[model samples]
Target: MRSLEIHGVDDLRVVERAQPEPGPGEVQIAVEWGGICGSDLAYWRHGVSGTATMRHPFVLGHEVSGRVSALGPGVDGFAVGLPVTVHPARTSGPLPERLAGRDNLHPDLTYLGSAARDPHTDGGFAERITVRAEQVVPLPDGLDTRRAVLAEPLGVAIHAVHRAGDVTGAHVLVSGCGPVGLLTILAVRAAGAARVSAVDLSPLARERALALGADVALDAAEQLGQDVTVAFEASGAPASLEAILRVVARAAVVVQAGNLPPAPVSVALGPIVSKEIDYRGTYRFVSEIEEAVELLARSELAEGVISHELDLADAGAAFTTAATDPHSSKVVLRLE
Candidate 1:
């Protein structure tokens, strides 16, 4: 089997590795498609994402879709060749009593493709890889592996919206129209937001934002009036965060879904205090992949986000386009 691994900053390689078989309570998947995320680009370009620095070579993907090729002992109800996507996360240990249903906030957690822990958790970019059966999610009707590659990121978008509380009939602004921000537009639109608007420094992102059902797409540097009732900061840009605070109406809810740098950056603070904005921070999804899968199966919202599909052998070109091409969003590698 072959996998895409990152050795260090600007060092992404496609190398062959041994094929993995399913273990007890696990399943083996023949990977079909995988999406390159902003974090993946971060790890490649800067050797870091948040505080997780790339200290060792590891497979670099989590937004993946594939078909079950083998099922290990004790795994039932799934047949060979069943299409699936993975949840990409597992509790590092038993959740504490206080965090029972809120497993996303567990004190200890491991996410695929992350280097937060030493002996970093390997991801699902290989041609065939084995994982716990519970991590596999069957594809819903009307969705296939290519489009299903978006399941994970869309789940993040949905969870971010979930953190925003009630958006029904409210005017919402999504700052930074990257793949996640575009998907956030879809999530908010589906959640009954009356009018969705987006802001981004990239013209490509703004175009994607409008294509994903946002009512208007504005340049990030433009002056924004305080009419939005809700706002989501998905750009991960510190400057955008400062601007978002100045634009949203007083008492509006703000959800920060983008991962900011670990180092401190200057941000204006007066509006947050004077306006009493409910600035909430959201991490990864807590089982919202199920809903994201359902949404993908029913609508074509995700299809527009996938702008390129390159073969796994072309991982270099894939990562390059994903990192440097502002016109491209959700660059997927065809693993099969």
Candidate 2:
């Protein structure tokens, strides 16, 4: 079987690899679609994401969906050919007392496609792969692999919404209209936020945010004249985060969902002191992926997010488009 692997910066290759089979309490899947994530681009361009430097060649995907091909011993409630997505997290140890029930915050977590740890974990950007049965999630009925492929990112959006506290009927601002930001708009709207405003530097991103049900899409440089009760910083740009701090209403909730630079960048903090905003940070996700699947199965939220889909044979084009084209939201690779 052929798989996409990253050796170093600008060194992604499609190479032949032995097909993996399921182990005890595992599930083997024939991957159909793999969504290119910001982290993937980081690994491809700089051999690192945040501080997770690439140690060697490894598969490059976490957002993926496919059909079950085989189930290992002790696996139940799943059958061959069942549509599925995965949580992509494998907890290696116990959680802290204060962080109980939040598996995403586990100190010893191994996520698929992450180079965070030594002997980095491989991902599902291949024709076939196996994951522990516990991580495999059956897709909701009527949800195809194309949309289910977005469950991971949608989970990030949902988790960000949760971090922002209650947004029901409140004015929310999403600072960035990339794939994650657009999905954040869907999540906030679904959570009953009365108005959803999005901001992005890219015209294509701004336009797509509106198409996905944002009440209004603004340029990143503009400030919202009205009060923003909750704001999500989805652009990694430090300026965007600073601008958000300046405009939110007093005592508002601000969730940082985007990946800021690994190194420190200066930003104004006066607004936080004056307004007493609840500035919070959100990581990948928790058990929200199940909720994301249910939501995607019911709505067209992820439909407009897929701007391009290429076959595994054209993986380079897929990565190039995802890295260079701001207009392309989600660049998917059809592995099957």
Clashes of each: 0, 0
Report RMSD for candidate 2: 1.0
Q: Candidate 2, 153: how far from true, in Å? A: 0.2
Given candidate 2, what's the lDDT at residue 128?
94
lDDT of 2 by residue, 225-281 (tens): 748989999988899999999888899999999999989899998989999989999
Q: Candidate 1 residues 1-336, lDDT tens each? A: 899999999898899999987889999999999999888888999989888888899989999999999999999989999999999988777888987777789888888898988899889899998888889999987898899999999999999999999899999999988889989999999999999989987887888888899888888634667788899998788898898888889999989988887788899978999999999999989999999999889888779999889999899899999878868888999999
Q: Candidate 2: which stretches are off by over 4 Å?
A: none
Each model's TM-score? 0.97, 0.98
Error of 1 at 80 (Å): 0.8
Candidate 1 ranges beyond 4 A from true positions: 221-223
